[model samples]
Target: MAVTRPLLDLVNVTAGYGQTPVLFDVDMSVAEGEIACLLGRNGVGKTTLLRSIIGLNALTSGNIYFNDADITKAPTYKRARKGIAYIPQGREIIPYLTVLDNLKMGFSASGKKAKRIPAEIYDFFPMLKEHLQRQGGLLSGGQQQQLAIARGLMCNPKIILLDEPTEGIQPSIVQEIEDTLRRINIEKGITIIVVEQKIEFARKLAQQFFIMEKGAIVEKGKTDKLADSLLHRYLAV
Candidate 1:
């Protein structure tokens, strides 16, 4: 069931690295059980914005609220413990670790005694089950991406942030990932905030969208009502 309150809220957030600000006075919110998309071209601070949300990057000012808790200064591990899962752009699974081990790492964030791997995860990505013993570095790119996502799920997150999930991924696997995300949102009620450059992919999956340019939000609205002219102006090559 969707919570009445917004799952994630950023109020007047100003964040960056080492006195160099990448985001300025950015205010955004994602409602419970909704897919919110952050769309932008490369080098527009999209990644920086996501890193700020997860506490991977420092917030020079403002507050971040997750499930109504003030978490502006929370460490990355603390945020993960609070059920904020971040799937970064590069599918950075431990190359030497077996697929099973990487998945187990995700469960550590749950702070519970995990007796068994959730069957639902395998159901979502059957290939993972088949490659339980395989090393992460040995799998194909698509398979590695699936592993990365499965690892995040082990944390039992309330909301998942995906950054450029389709980057360098095969089309078929991209579709698989998209379908799984939709199912997770509909059935499990996991709220999602996806940072994507593919306009069609974002349009199909997001209920609401925010367009960023040069470190600021340039456009935002319901996905269905996203102005084509604005998209053209912001996204044209």
Candidate 2:
């Protein structure tokens, strides 16, 4: 049998803001086309982990690898051009920019020439097509989240890092987001690593999971194997 390596790898990654450290010697990997979830209670550094992967937070000590190259010190824009897309916790759409322009921004981040929005973007997010001219801030929270995801896809990334994607959304929209992510993974062959608080959503969306506490991963395994004890210990309020 042929050996397969992870498409994205974090080897002993330790990062933080300024003098205060947050992530401590963290190690993680996501195989090609896999959906992995990072779960934990508040202040466990899940968002910091995602930020580290996207080069937003500088590594204190350790290496990050993507497509077999070390990218620990790469600039944020360089990481984006190298096929890593990050959709942060807040959905961070430009309040005044039209939905079409926000999606174009993602394309521009990849150092690509600005052009017509990709038709496939509409296929993945049909609602965005309807609100192309609408200001992003005027849309509902769920709509904004969808627009954020569609914007990430504009970069044609090999892997996408989503932080708290289902936060502040209604149940119906949550289900839609789940289904669309599955399709994006299966059809587009993009690997995903999501930082999520909702256990049920993580269970349905991810194949592999990691539980973090105090800036380090305490547990990890196949999603189906995640136990109630694990959840109660690390996730319960």
Candidate 3:
């Protein structure tokens, strides 16, 4: 039998801003086509871990491997071009740009000429098509999150990191986003590493879980028995 390696792996990674270490000796792995969630209380370095994976926060020590290749030192653009996309905590859509233009920006990472918005994008977000001419900032919070996710999809990434995607969004729209993400994962075979505070959202979407505390992962395993007390320590927030 062949031993399959994880698509994304972090070996003893330590990262942070300047000299301050936000992640300490973090070891994590995510196999291809898997949905994994990082759960943690606020200020526990969940976002920092995503930043490290995407090359925004340089690893002070240790290594990062994506698709079994070392990317610890790769620049942010290089990582983006290599099929890693990040939708940050705040849904950083360009406010002044039209929704269409914001989606167009995803093509930049693909190193491909901007063409018509991919049909699949509209399929996943039909509402965006209706509001294509509107400025991104004009959209409500839920709509903007959808736009940001749509933009991430436009990059045609193999792996995407989502930070607190449900934060500040209406439950109805959150459900929509969850359904779309499941479709994307099942249809496109994309891998996701999401940082989420909601247990129901995490349990519904991610098959695996990693719980973080004080800038380090304290527990990790399959989603079975989500009521386990260990999870409460982090989920309590």
List of clashing residue pairs for candidate 3: none
Candidate 3, position 161, lDDT: 97
Question: Backbone collision count in every prediction?
Answer: 0, 0, 0
Candidate order by decreasing TM-score:
2, 3, 1
Error of 2 at 200 (Å): 0.6
Residue pairs with backbone overlap in model 2: none
Tens digits of lDDT, candidate 2, 39-104: 999998999999989888899899999988889899999999999999999999998999989889
Cα-lDDT of candidate 1:
0.89
Ranking by lDDT: 2, 3, 1
TM-score of model number 3: 0.97
lDDT of 3 by residue, 1-237 (tens): 866669999999999888788999999999999999999888999999999999989888999999867999999988888899999999999999999999999999878889989899999999999999999999999999999989998878989999999999999999999999999999999999999988889999999999999988899999875655976566663
lDDT of 2: 0.93
Local distance difference test scores for all models: 0.89, 0.93, 0.91
Native RMSD of candidate 1 (Å):
2.3
Name the candidate, 2 or 3, with the larger TM-score value: 2
Give candidate 2's TM-score.
0.97
Candidates in order, TM-scores: namely 0.95, 0.97, 0.97
Q: On residues 14-57, what C-alpha lDDT tens digit does candidate 1 reach at each position?
A: 88778778898888999999999999888888889899999998
Question: Model 1: clashing residue pairs?
Answer: none
